[model samples]
Target: MPKAKVGRKKAVLSGNHYTSRRFDVVAVGASAGGFHAIAELLGPLPANFTGSILVVQHLDPARKSLLADLLLRHTALHVKQAEHGEIMLPGVVYIAPPDEHMLAGPGKIQLAHTHLVRFSRPSIDLLFESVAGMYGSRSVGVILSGTLKDGSAGIRAIKEAGGVTLAQDPAEAEFKSMPQAAVATGCVDYTLPLNKLGITLKNLYEAGSPKSYG
Candidate 1:
């Protein structure tokens, strides 16, 4: 993908003028050993976080996922399995349903029953690519603990689209291959420990205008 030009204007403006949040959407991808890492990452975010969080964690299609329920224990934000055509909301955490590819549109969520990529049905690359396409500079992509390089291309797509990209520090990841691969792409802007991700995201979301944040 070619590098997308960063727009000078804000992609979205909230009803409240007092907020200076820059990004509109945050996309996270993980696989093996991701549950604990995700829980830790989401634990510190304030309930009023200004961006919507969309997650794609590899799961077994044969069984129903309890990701939302499990994550609810870790964060104050409302957590649920994303449904097709639902409007994306600030401060909510949406998890991709098992076997479905979750995609972000202008202001809505989309689900596709497409073939798997990288041997994963809910491909992280697909979700991040769609997010990059829809939100451009007003998006964030994160790669967490996992076994494979599923998020590498997706993170690069986000960077190419002028979005911020973050990767968990491989040294701290229970399954380092995923984060390591993302960092190796040379696209990630931050390589942080899991414990710091939530606070960093909070700071990023509460930052000034787009230019100021960039």
Candidate 2:
């Protein structure tokens, strides 16, 4: 993969299809020990957060997802499992449904149950890729605690699209594989602990400040 350059050309999608920068979508991915980690990350954001949040979590399709319900206790953001064709809105968190791929484009969300990527339906790459495709630099990709490399490529795609990418610090991750893989790609812009991510993201939204590692 090529190193991302600022203001570079937008990536091409299917024949002549291109995306415009919408800049307020946040895409997050995790697996294994995701529930608590995700909650912690979202906990600090105020009810008035100005960005839309989308998440892809590894789950058994046979079991019903309680993630949206779980997160409702943590953040003031309106949380729900994604519904096909619903408009993406700020301050709302959309959870990818089990056994389905969740994709987003300008003003719309699409769900597909056709196939899996990396042996996982609702692949992190699919969500991050679509968000990066549509939002460009205005997008944010977060890879948290998990047991595989599911989110690595997606963060890279986000970086190449001029979006910001964050990985949970491996030292702080309950399961380090996913965040470690994402960091190894050198595309991630921040390797932050879960406690700091929400506040940092809030700073990004409020001031457009360039984040610095300590």
Candidate 3:
């Protein structure tokens, strides 16, 4: 098969699909032991954080989402399940709905309930790939505690697109498979402990600094 003429799509912040440096979006993925870990990571981020946060957490399609309420009780950022077509806005945390794939667009969002990636709904790789596609190199992707290999491919996509990628230190992860697999892909730029991730996020947003470790 011939390669597509336009290989990777980009959401530009300027002319000719170019984007100036900015920390306007943050995408996080986790599964297995995500509930507790998410609270720990997001609770410390200030309400004034200057980046929009999108999360893809493994969950049952038939189950109710306590995640938004759970995290809301812990963080100052407004937490809610994402609404299709909503633009990314700083200080708001959008959670991916169950049994759906969440994709990022130019300051906007799109959600689908089609095929699953890696046998999971609210697929992490789907979210990461889409975000990297839209944001180019200006996004942040975090792979947290989980028990499978869901996030590695997504992390690779983000890295290739020039986005900063972070994985929780495997040793510190409650279930290390996901983060460890991501590390094995050789794309992770930071292997932070749970505590430091919050601090790092704060620094990234506040200082307008981009940390690329890999």
Candidate 4:
């Protein structure tokens, strides 16, 4: 009989703690001058990153969103508008579609045309709250440049869930209101410049399975 071939299994770090600890989901919210901010924010992720990233950047519902297309030009991560029931994948970025509220569930995405929250259809609060409930301490919440108070409550929700929360430095943001509001909540773990946010996240992810936001 001919010898049968077997595929090699990818090696993963093994330990009881490593198996239990996870930092696998990152959720980001932005508005106002967010298009450019998000592009810069996502530009630095290495191709092999294992965390799935979900983003909500407020957009005009009456107009088509070119956000995914625009972002695909600058980053290594696969970018696309979130679809209902879609399973999120590592190294991919999902953006909320215009007019639809996108949410993270246990292992899938849920898209809804629900009532406007805080006067926005794709509310940052809605997305962050869902992500917090699903991923808990494994989640990362980032608030970027924007206006009004959209991401403040969301980041607070993330903190309450034991997730790591971050905000772009208000002084560095084109529109400081959003980041300022998030910082004022006292829930954020880090307030960093746009250029430093990626590297900071990389360091946290590389610190080997974060068990606590501390």
lDDT of 1 at 138: 85
For residues 1-214, write the lDDT of model 1, one tens digit per residue.
Answer: 2221222122221244324436888999999999998998899888877688999999999999999999999999999999999988888899999999999997889999998899998999999999999888888998999988998999999999988888888988999999999989999877777766766676677663432211
lDDT of 3: 0.79
Span of ten consecutive residues with least summed lDDT in model 4 = 1-10
Off by over 4 Å in 1: 1-21, 209-214
Error of 1 at 134 (Å): 0.6
TM per candidate: 0.87, 0.86, 0.86, 0.87
Q: Rate the local accuracy (lDDT) of all candidates.
A: 0.84, 0.82, 0.79, 0.82
- Score candidate 1 by TM-score against the native: 0.87
Please write out the lDDT profile of model 2 over residues 85-167, one tens digit for every residue: 99888788999999999998776789999787998899999999998888788889999999879988899999999997877
Least accurate stretch of 10 residues (summed lDDT) in model 2? 9-18
Q: Judged by TM-score relative to the true structure, which candidate is superior, 2 or 4?
A: 4
Q: Model 2 scores what on Cα lDDT?
A: 0.82
RMSD of 1: 7.3
Q: For this target, which candidate reaches the highest lDDT against the unseen true structure?
A: 1
Candidates ranked, most accurate by TM-score first: 1, 4, 2, 3
Model 2, stretches more than 4 Å misplaced? 1-22, 209-214
Off by over 4 Å in 4: 1-21, 210-214
